[model samples]
Structures are given as structure tokens and as C-alpha cells.
Target: MLTILAAIAPNFLLILLGWLLRARHVLDGPFWLQTEKLTYFVLFPALLVTNLAEARLDGLPVAAILGAHGLGITLVLGLLVLPLRFLSPRLRADGPAFTSVLQGAVRPNTYVGFAIAAAIWGPHGVTVTALASSLVIPLVNLYCVTALIRWGSGGGKRGLGATVLAIAKNPLILACVIGAALNVSGIGLPPIVGPLLKILAQASLALGLLCVGAGLEFSALRGAHGPVAAVLGLKLAVMPLAVGALAWSFGLTGTTLAVTVTYAALPVAANAYILARQLGGDHALTAAIITASTMAAAVSLPVVTLLIGYLP
Candidate 1:
């Protein structure tokens, strides 16, 4: 237990450090925002490409893992969607707030997932995570975009074709596809390029965690307790338990099971608030869900690790 906690402690500590930095105003808002953009557009993609390009992919159960993970997320989405039909008229009438609930229920923070996977399972874990991200990212984006468009106030203004195109051009997805291609082709990276990518990849972990910290906003939770609590329960508790069961049933074990569960247990993505704001959803509620889920994960994740340790 101590060993598992020891592994995850530093990653969360980095997040805490980021929160401290932001709280102290050591770095201004624009700096953190730009840092997030750089990390997302450049550093993270470099990490994915370098890791995936070098990964030994011969024997991994790529299909089964993707299938099981996708199924798990789909089930969660279905469960969350069902409740919307039964919500109070007042709650149901609030399109933005409902959209916030939906986003919180489904989005997983891959930045934190990467940091945790690398810390717990090393390179092989990262390889599996990258692969999982390739499949999961597009799937979640499709669903979230659909929900935003269907239920958000200005969602109708955004064309489906444009949303699809934007997702297609997402840097992270592009990185995964290109890296997987390189892995399969066996062309690998040039010697000079590999070292440069390595440096960017290393920079991503700390910076990414810090950005995640800086993005946290707890003040929004006050007025939105009910919905926020529900989202947090679904995101941090229900989703991981459900996904872990599915992974086990699919015969995943060791690092594969561990990484998948960790990924599932991640908080709502920071980008959820952005999407909510863009589409006229309840951005405040979305931000609160992100903050609450992230804080909850510090405890939930270690408990999850301990549970995985006891699994056969």
C-alpha cells in the first residue's frame, strides 16, 4: 500500500505545487494559459510520438484493450444520459447546466493519466496509454461535441461538420496516429530527431501537471453542490470501478489493468470548461466538477492502486 501511495504521491504533489504557484500569483493567468497551449500543442504530442514510435508493439492486445475501454466509456455515457430524461423540469430546462453535467460525467484528464501511468508503470505503461488514448480521445470528443451541440444554448450554431473536422485535426490524435504508423512501419525516428523529442517529452510531465494545477478552480463549487457531487461520484468513483471490471473481464492484468483503471479514474478534463464556455454550457459548474474530481482523485487513485495490487 505504501509502495503504491509512494508511486502516486509525487505526481499529485506536482499538481499541488501548481495550485500553490497559481494561488501565490507567482505566475499570472496568461502565462499559465500559454503554458497549457504549448504543452498541449507541442510537448504532449512530442511525448506521444516519441513514446509510440519506440514502443515494442508486437504482442500487445491492442484490439481487446481498446474494445473493453470503449465499451466501459460507452456504458458510462449511456448511464449518465438516461438520467437526463428524468431530471426535474427546472434542471432539465437549464441547457447549459445539463451540458456541464454531461461533460463532467464523461471527460477524462489525459495529462494526469500520462503522469500517473509513467510514474506507476514506466514506458510499457505509457505505450499502452498512448494506444488507449488514440481510441478513446476521438470517441469521447464525438460524444461530448454531440451533447454540447444538442443540449447547449448555442450548440446549434456550431456545425457538426466543423466539429468533426476540428477533432480530426486535434494535435494529440494526430500525434497518436502518426506515432502508431511509425511503430508499425518500423522506420523509427532518425537519431537526431529522437533525442529532441525525448527532451520535449520529459518537459511535458512536470509542465503538464503544473498546468493542470493552475487550471483548478474550487470557488465555483459553492452554488452547484448537487450536480457537482453527482458528477464527481460518477467520474472519480463509478467510472473507474466500472472500467476496471470491464478490463478484468476482458482478461487484462498487471500494468495493462493498472493503467486502464488509472486512466478511467482521472478527473474531468480541464478542456471541459472550455467546451462548455464555447457552446454556452454552465462553465462554472463544469469548472467546479473538474476541480472537485481532481482533488478527490488524490485519495481515490491511491485506493485504486491498492485494490489493483490485491487483484489476481
Candidate 2:
């Protein structure tokens, strides 16, 4: 247990540090906005491309890993959407709020997942983390965009084509595709370029965690208690357990199992709020969900790590 805490503590502490720095006015809103943009567009993608481009794919359980994780997410999407479809208009009336519930239930913080996985399992762990993200990101985005279109106010009118275009243009997805292509093609980056990308990848983890901390908003939790609680339960507890069991059933073990479950257990991504705002979803509820789930992860993650350790 202490070993698990040792792995989990620094990640959450960086989040706490970011929160503390923001609360003390050490960094203002605009700084964090630009920082987030830099992390999302430049640094994080560099990390993904670098790690994945150089990853050893030999003997990796790519099919089983993607299948297990994908199945878990697909099941969760149905679980949330189907019941909501039959609910009273008053409960489901707000399009944006419904979108928030969807985002909160499924999205995982890739930045945190990468950091924690690395801490626990080193480079092999990061490889599994990146691979899981490559497979999961597109599917999660597809579901969220579909929810926004079906339930969101004005944006739903854009139709399926726009949603497909948006997912295609996502930087993270593009990075994943490029990186995997390079890996499979057996092409390596030039010496100078490799070092530069390595440097950026290192910067990404620290800066990304801080940005996650800065994005946390506590006030949004005030009136949205019910939705907030439900999301935390789904993201932190239920999703991980479901995904872990499915992955085990598919014969995934060791680093692959650990990384898949860790990703499942992560909080709702900060980008959930951004998607909510852009698509006219309830950004406030999304923010609250992100904050609550992230805060809950400090406890939930250690428990998850221990549980996976006990699994065959």
C-alpha cells in the first residue's frame, strides 16, 4: 500500500501545487489559458509522437488491449445515454447539462494517466499509456460529439460530417496516428530532432499537471451536487472496475492491464469543460465534474493500483 502511495502522491501533489499557485495569484487566468494551449497543441503531442514513434510493438497485445478498453467505454456510453433517453423532460431538458454528464462519465485525463503510469512502470508503462490513449481518444470524442449534437443547444445542427471533421483534426489523434505510422514503418527520427522531442516530452508532464491544477474550479460544485456525485462514481469507481474486468477477460496482464485500468480510473479530462463550452454544453457542470473526479483520484488511484496488483 505504501508503495502504491509512493507512486501516486507526486502526481496529485503537483495538481495540488498548481491549485495552490493559482489560488495565491501566482499565475493569472490568461497565463493558464496559454499554458493549456501550449500543452495541448505542442508539448503533449510531442510527448505522444516521441514515445509512440520509438515504442517496441513486438509481441504487444494491440488487438486485445484496444478491444477490451473500447468495449468498456462503449458499454458505459450506452449505460448513461439509454436511461437518460427515457427520463422526464425536466431532468433531461438541459442539453448542455446532459452533455456534461456524458463527458464526465467517460473522459479520462491522459496527462495524469501518463504521469502515473510512468511513475509506476517507467517507459514500458508510458508506452502502454500512449497506446491506450490512441485507441480510446477517437472513440470517446465520437461519443461526446454525438451527445453534444443530439442534446446540445445550437451545435447539434452541424450534423455528422462536422463531427467527423472535428475528430479528424484533433491534435492528439493526429499525433497518435503519425507516431504509430512511424513506429510500424521502422523509421527513426534524426538525432537532433529526437533529443528536442525528448526535451518537450519531459516539459509536457510537469506543465500539463500544473495546468490541470489551475483549471480546477471548486465553485461550480455548489448547485450541481447530484450530477457531480454521479460522475465521480462513474469515472473513479465504476469505469475502472468494469474496464479492468473486461481487459482481464480478454487476457491482458502486467503493464497492459495496469495501464488500461489506470487510464480508466483517471478523472474526467480538463478538455471536457472546453468541449462543453464550445458545443454549448453546461461548462459549469463539466468543470465541477473534472474538479471533483480529480480530487477523488488521490484516494481512488491507490485503491485501483492495489486492486490490479492483486489480480492474476
Candidate 3:
């Protein structure tokens, strides 16, 4: 247990440190904003492209990983999010609120997942993490966008073509596609491009966590007891367990298994709130879910990490 704590502490502490720095105004708002933009567009995509390009994919259980992740998410949606879509209008005063809750439950913070996986399993963990991201990013976006269109006030006005366009334009997904192309084609990263991407990738983990911390909206949590709790339960608890069990059933073990669970255990994506606003879901509720899930994951992830060793 202590070993697990030792491994995971720095990542969460970086988040706390980010919160502290932001709270203290150590760096002004504009600097953090630009840092976030840099990490999202340039640094993190470099990490994805670099890792996916060089990863030892031939030996990996690609099919099992895909199955476990896809099935696990579909399971959750079938049991929870989808049902809520049918009922959110009558059951809840704010019908669009379900979209935020749904996003909170399924979408994961890949930045945090990457940092934690790297801390725990080094290069292999990061590779598995990227592999999971490649799958999870598109899957979650499709589900969330569909849910938002059905439930969010303004989302129904947007065409399916626009959603398709947005997902195609997503930087991380594009990086994954490009990297996989290079890997499959056996072309690989060019000598110069590989080294440059490595440098940029190296900068993403720390800055990404800091941006996560700085973006947290603690004030949003107040008076949002029910939705926040629902999201935390599904995201921090149900999603990881379901994904882990499915992955295990598919014969994943050791670092690969651990990283897959880590992917699910991650908090809701920081971008969900932005999506909520754009789609006219309850953006305030989305913020609450993000803050609540992030704080809860700090404890839940360590426990999950410690328990990973005991899995059958």
C-alpha cells in the first residue's frame, strides 16, 4: 500500500500544487490560460504522436484492449446514461442536466491518466495509456455528443455533420490516427521529428496536471449534491471496476491491465464544461461534476492502484 502511495503521490500533489499556485496568484491568469492551450494543442499531441508512433504494438493485445474498453463503456451507457436520457426530462427539473452528468460519468481526463500511468508503469504504461486514449477519445465523444444533442437545449440545433467534423478535428484523435498510420506503415517517426516530439512530449505531463488543478472550479460543487455524487459514483467507482473486470476477462495483466483501469479511474475530462456550454447543457452542473470527480479520484485511484496487485 505504501508503495502504491509513493508512486501515485507526486501526480496528485502536482495537482494540489497547481491549485495552490493558482489560489495564491503566483502566476497571473493569462499565463495559465496560455499554458493550457499550449499543452492541449502542441505538447500533449506530441506525446500521443511520439508514443503511439514508437510503441511496440505487434506484441500487444490490441483486440482485447479494444474490446475491454469498448464493452465497458457500452455497459455503463446501457445501464445508466442511456436510461437517464429517456427519463431526465420527467425525473429532473433541468432536462439538460443529464448531459453533463452523462459526460461526467464516461469522459476521462487523459492528461491525468497519462501522468499516473507514467508514474506507475514507466514507458509501457504510457504506451498502454495512449492506446486506451486512442480508443476512448472517439468512443466517449460520440456517446457524449449524441447524448448532448438529444438532451441539451441548443445541441439539437447542431447537425450531426458538425459533430462529425468536430471529432475529426480533435487534436488527440488526429494524433492517434497519424501515429497509428506511421506505426502500421512501418515508416515510423523521422529522426528529426522523433526527437523534437520527445522534447515536447516530456513537457506535457507536469504542465497538463497543473492546468487540471488550475481549471478546477470548487465553487461549482456547492448545492449540487445529487448530480455531483452520481457522477463521482459512476466515474470514480463503477467505470474503473467494470473496465478492469472486462479487461481481466480478456487476459490483460500487469502494466497493461493496470493502465486500462487507470484510464477508467481518471476524473472527468476538463473539457466537458466547455462542451456543456457550447451544447447548452448545464455547464454549471458540468463544472460541479468535474470538481467533485477530480477530488474524489485523488483518494479512489490510490486505493485502486493498491488493489490492482491483488486482482485474480
Candidate 4:
């Protein structure tokens, strides 16, 4: 237990520091906003690219791990669409709200997942996490955008082509693609290039966590309704359990299993609100879901760590 706490504590501490800094006005809102932008567009991508490019891929259960995530995500999507989406009277009455719920249920904060993986499993774990991100980032974004456009009161104006284009430009997906390509090609990282991305990757987690802490919206969850509660269940609870089960069936265990479950268990991506606002989904609820899931994760992550340890 002490070891577990020690592994996880620094990541949460950085988040707390970010919140405190934001609350105290040590840095203005715009500064953090730009910081997030830099992390998203720059540092985070560098980290993903570096890990994927350099990771030892020879012995990994790449296909099984991918299948587990793909199936897990599809299972969650089915649950969201058939029962809650089509059958629930409350969600039917509020399309934008439903989209927010769907987005919250599917997206994950990679920053948190990456931080935890590095803390618990080191570089090898980060490599596996990045490998999972290769698929999850694009798949989740595509699903979220599709849902928003279909159901959002203000979305779908640009049509499906535009949606494809948007996902194409996503830095995370691009980074994954580039890194995977380099790894497969066997060219490997060049001298200067390797060092540059390593430096950027080192800065990614701390800055990203700070941004996450700064963005917490405690008040948004105050009157949080059915959607928020449902999302909490889906993102934090159901997703991990489902993923862990399916992953074991698919032969993932130990580090791979834990990292995949962590990915599934992470809070909604911090940037989900941006997509919600732009696409006319319920951005407020999205914010609320992000904050609530993040708070929920502090407990849920530890539980997951302990539980996975008990696994053979």
C-alpha cells in the first residue's frame, strides 16, 4: 500500500499544485490556456512520438491489446447508444446533453494515464500506453465527433468530410502515426531528433497535469444531473472493468493489462469541453463530467492498482 501511494502521489500533487496556482492567480487564465495549447500541440505529441519510436515492440501482445481496447470501446458505445441514448426519455429530450454524456463516457485524459504509467511501470509502461493511444485517440475522437454532429443542436453543419478532416489534424493521432511508422520502418530516431523529443517528453506530464488541475470546475458538478452521474459510472467504473475483462480474455496481463485498464479508467479528456462547445454539445455538462471524473479517479485509480495486483 505504501508503495502504491508513493507511485501515485506525485501525479496528484502536481494536479493540486496546478489548481492552487490557478486559484491563487499566480498565473492568469490566458497563460494556462496558452500553456494547454502548447502542451496539446507540442509537448504531448512529442512524448507520444518519442515513446512509440523508441519502444521495444518485439515481444508485446500488440494485436491482443488492440483488440481488447477496440472491443471494450465498442461495447461501451453500444451501451450508450442503445439503452441510454435511444430508450431513455431524459436524454432524448436533450440532444446536446446526451452528446456530452457520450463524449464524457468515451474520452480519457491521456496525460493522467501516461503519468500514472510512468510512475508505476516506467518507460516500458509508457511505451505500451502510447501504443494503446495510437488507436484510442483516433477511435474515441471519431466516435465523439460523429455523435456530436449527429445529435448536437449546433453540430453537423460542416458534414462528415469535415469531421474526418478534424480528426486527421489531431496532434495525438498524428504523433502516433508518425512514431509507429518510424518504428515499423526500422529507420529509428536520428541523433538530434531523438534528444529533442526526449527533452520535450520530459516536460509533457508536469505541464499537462498543471493544466488539468487548473481547469477543474467544482461548481459545474454542483447541480449535476443524470447525464453526469451516468458518465461517472461509464468512464470511471464500467470502462475499466469491461476493458480488464476483455483484455484478460485476449491474453493481456501484468503491465499491458494494467496500462490498458488505466487508459480505460482515466477521467474524460480535459479538452472534451472544447469540442463540446465548438460542436454545440452541452459544454457545461462536459466540464462537469471532466471535473467529477477527475476527482473520482483519485480513489478509483488506487482501487484499480490494488485490484490488478491481486490478479494472477
Candidate 5:
């Protein structure tokens, strides 16, 4: 238990610090916008590109891990979509919006997951997890975008070409593709290039977390507790459990299994709201779900750590 707490303490501390910074108004709106832009458009992509470019590809159960995480997420999302009665009139009004919000709630936060992996399992773990994330993030983003757009936008018809364009144009996806190409080509990063990438990768997590914390809100969840809790349960509990079982069934054990399950247990990506809002989904509800799931992950992540620690 002590070891588990020790592994997770840093992440929780960062969140608390970000919260405190917001409480003291150290982060203004413009600062947050800039921070988010830098994190998403530059730091995150650089991190993904660099980490994945040099990842060791030998003997990794890459497919099984990615499949397990995706399957777990899909199942949880499907279950969350089931129609439910909200007795509260206020909640009833917000319920549809909550569905889109909840989609973001169930997806893992890759930045935080990679940071935790580094702390818990060292640099090798970081590289492996980053590679896994490179595969996961684009797919998850597409899923969220598709779901929120279809559900919240009142069934607007979208062309497949536009969807493909969106995926192609996403900075994160583009970074991942470039990284994979570099990795497969067997050309090592040049001297200056490696350091430059490392600098960006290192800054990605802390800055991203700070902006995420600054964006957290309680009022969005106040009257919609039931749906929020439901999303949290699926995200923090159900998804990890499903990932563990599916990963085991597919013959993934040891570090691969540990990484997959731990990441699956991570909170929804903080950027989910930004994406939803950008693409015309329910922004307020997405914010609420992001806030609730992130808080719950403080507990859920430790539980996953213990599970992985005890793995045979």
C-alpha cells in the first residue's frame, strides 16, 4: 500500500498544486489558453513523436494491449449510452449533453498516464507506454468526436472525407505517424534533434495538467450527479477491469498487461472538452465530466497500481 501511494503521490501532488494555483488565481484565462495551445499544438506532439520514434518494438504485445484498451473503452461507452431516467428536471435537461460529456469521461488521459509510467516503471516503461499511447490517442479522439458529433449535433450528416481529413490534420495523429515512420526507417535522431524533442516531451505533462486543473468546474456536475457518477464508474472501474480480463485472455502479461490496465484506469483526457467544444458538442457538460473523472482518478490510479504490482 505504501509503495502504491508512493508511485501515485507525484501525480496527485501535481493536481493539488494546479488546483491551488487556480484557487490563488495564479493562472489567468489568457495564460491557460496559451498553456493549452502550447501543450497541445507543440509540446504533446513533440513528446509523442520523440518517445515513439525511439521506442523498442521487439516482443511488445502492441496489438493486444491496444485492442484491450479500445475494447474496454467501447464497452464502457456503450453501457453509459443506455437510456436512464433522471427524476430531477434539471438533470433531465442536461442528460443528452451528459452523454457527450461522459464519452470524454471514459477515455484515458495519456499525458498523465505516461508521466505515471515513468515514475513507476522507469524510462523503458515510459517508451513502451508512449508507443501504446501513440496508437490509442488518435483512435480515442476519433471515437469521441464521432460519438459527440453524432449524438449531440442532432444527426447532422458528415462525409467520410471530412472525417478522414479531420484525423489526418490532427496534430497529435500527424506526430504519431511521423514518429512511426522514423522508428521503422531505423534512422536515429540527430544530436541536436534528440535533446530538442526531450525538452518538449518533458514540458508536456506538467503544463497540460496545470491547464486541466484550471479548467475543472463543480457547478456543471452539481445537479447532474447521477450521470456524472455513472461515467466515473465506467471510466475508473469498469474499463480497467475489462482491459485486465481482455488483455489476459489475449495472452498479455507482465509489463504489457500492467501498462494497459493502468492506463485504461486513467482519467478522461483533459483535452476532451476542448475537442468537443471545438467540434460543436456540449462544452459545459464535457467540462463537468472532465472535472469529475479527473478527481476520481486520484483514487482509481492507485488501485490499478496495486493490481499491476501484484501481477504474477
Candidate 6:
């Protein structure tokens, strides 16, 4: 128990530090935005490319990871969208944005997941999970962006082709794809390229999480408690537990199992909220969900970490 607690304590402290810095106005919005952009557009992609470029995906339990992640998300999406489909006309207007917020609440924050993965499982685990995320992120973002845009646009007739094109143009997804290709092809980046990417990847964890904390909208959290509760319950508890069971059923163990479950358990990403607001989705509801789930994960993560330690 103490080992598990010790492993997770540093991550929780770093997030709290991020929140404190933002609360104290030590990190301003423009700075946070620029940092987040750099992380998203440059650092994270570079990291993914670098880490995954040399990975061997053979015998990696890719199916289990994919199954756990996909099934959990599919179930949560249906649960969120069905009830939202019946809201009043006026309230129904907010349904798409509201559903987008729910997606954001349930989606895991890969930045935080990466940081904790490195701390608990070291370089090898980081490399492997980076590889996993390189695959997972593109698909996840594609679904999220499409859902948010479609709903926010009132289900207007935008072709699926257009959505695919839009997702294809996303820089983050592009980077992940390129990285995964390099990994599968067994190509080695030039020495200079690898080092540069490594530096950015290292910086991404702290900088990204700090920007995430800075972006948390306390004002939006007010008057959204009931919806926030439903979102948080599914995101922090249900989703992770579901993933854990799937992982066990498949006989996954060691760091793969630990990282997989922990990744599943991460709070709804801050980016989800940002994307929601940008696309006319319910920013306040997204904000409420992100903030509430992130705060709750501080407790839930430790519990899951301990559970993983006990797994056969």
C-alpha cells in the first residue's frame, strides 16, 4: 500500500503545484495557451515520434488495450448521448455541447498519463505506452472532434468525408501516425532528431499538465453539480474499473497492465474542454466535468494503483 501511495504521490503534488501556480497568476493565459500549443503541436508529437519510432509492438497485448479503451468509451458515449437526446427544445439546444462535455469528462488525459507512467514504470514503460497512445490518440480525437462538431452544429449534414479530412489535417494526429509508422518500420531517427525529441517529450509532461491546470475554469464549474456528478462517476470510477476487469480477463500483468489501467483511470482531458468551447460546444459544462473529474482522480488513481499492485 505504501509503495503504491509513494508511486502516485509525486504526480498528485505536481498537479497541485500546477493549480497553485495558475491560481496565483504566476502563469498567465497567453503563456499557458502558447505552452499548450507547443506541447500539442510540437512537443507531444515529437515525443510520440521519438518514443514509438523504435518500439517493437510484437506481443504487446495491443488488442486488450484497444478493447478496454474502445469498449469503455463506447459504453460511456451511449449512456451520455441517449438521455441527452430527449432534453427540452431550449435545453435540447444545449444537448450537443452537453454531450461533448460528457465525452471530455470521460476521456483520459494522456499528458498526465505519460507523466505517471514514466514515474512508476520508468523508461521502458514510457516507451511502450507512448507507442500505445500514438495509436489510441488519433482514433480518440477523431471520434471526439466529430461528435462535438456534429452535435454543436445541430446534426447538420456534414459529410463523413469532410470529418475525416478535418481529422487528417489535425497536426497531433498526423504526428502520431508518422511516429507509429516509424515504429513499425523499424527505422531509427538521426541522433540529433532523437535527442531533440527527447528533450521536448520531457518538457511536455510538466508544461502540459500545468497549462491544463491553468485552463481549469472555476467559474464554469458553478451550477453544474448534478451533471458533473454523473460525468465524474462514469469517468473516474466506472471507466477505469471496466478497463481493469478487461485487462485481468486477458491475463495482462506487470507494467503493461498497470499503465493500461492507470491510463484508463486518468481524469477527463483539459483539451476536451478547450475543443468543446472552440467548436460551440457547452464550454461551461465541459469545464465543470474536466475540473471535477481531475480533482476526483487524485483519490481514485491511488486506489487503482494499489489494486494493480495486487493483481496476479
Clashes of 4: 0
Model 3 C-alpha lDDT per residue in residues 1-312, reported as the tens digit of each score: 887788888988898888889999997789898998899889999999988888888789998888898999999988986676566554265667888888998999998888888777888898898888888888898888888887789998888899789878988889989888888889889999899999999999899888888888899888888778878889998999999999999999987898888888999988898789888789998988988888988899999988887775
**Number of the candidate with higher lDDT, 2 or 5:** 2
**C-alpha RMSD for every candidate:** 1.5, 1.5, 1.5, 1.1, 2.8, 2.6
Candidate numbers, best TM-score first, in rank order: 4, 2, 3, 1, 5, 6
Question: Candidate 5's residue-wise lDDT over 29-89, tens digit each?
Answer: 7878888889999999988888888888887877887788777767765654434324435
Worst 10 residues of 2 by lDDT: 82-91
- Predictions in order: lDDT: 0.84, 0.87, 0.87, 0.88, 0.75, 0.74
Give candidate 4's error at residue 18 in angstroms.
0.9
Using lDDT as the yardstick, the better of models 1 and 2 is 2
> Better model by lDDT, 5 or 6?
5
Candidate 5's clash total is 0
Question: lDDT by residue for model 2 over 117-231, one digit each (tens)?
Answer: 8999998889888888888888898888888887887567776788789889999989889888888888855578888988899999999999999999999889988888878
List candidate 3 stretches off by more than 4 Å.
Answer: 86-92
**CA lDDT for candidate 2:** 0.87
RMSD of 2: 1.5
How much does candidate 3 score in TM-score? 0.95
Cα displacement (Å) at residue 7, model 5 = 2.3
Clashing pairs in 1: none
Task: Judging by TM-score against the true structure, name the best candidate.
Answer: 4
lDDT of 6: 0.74
lDDT of 6 by residue, 134-177 (tens): 65677677667666656765323456676677678877778777
In angstroms, the error of model 3 at 179 is 1.0
Candidate 5: how large is its RMSD?
2.8
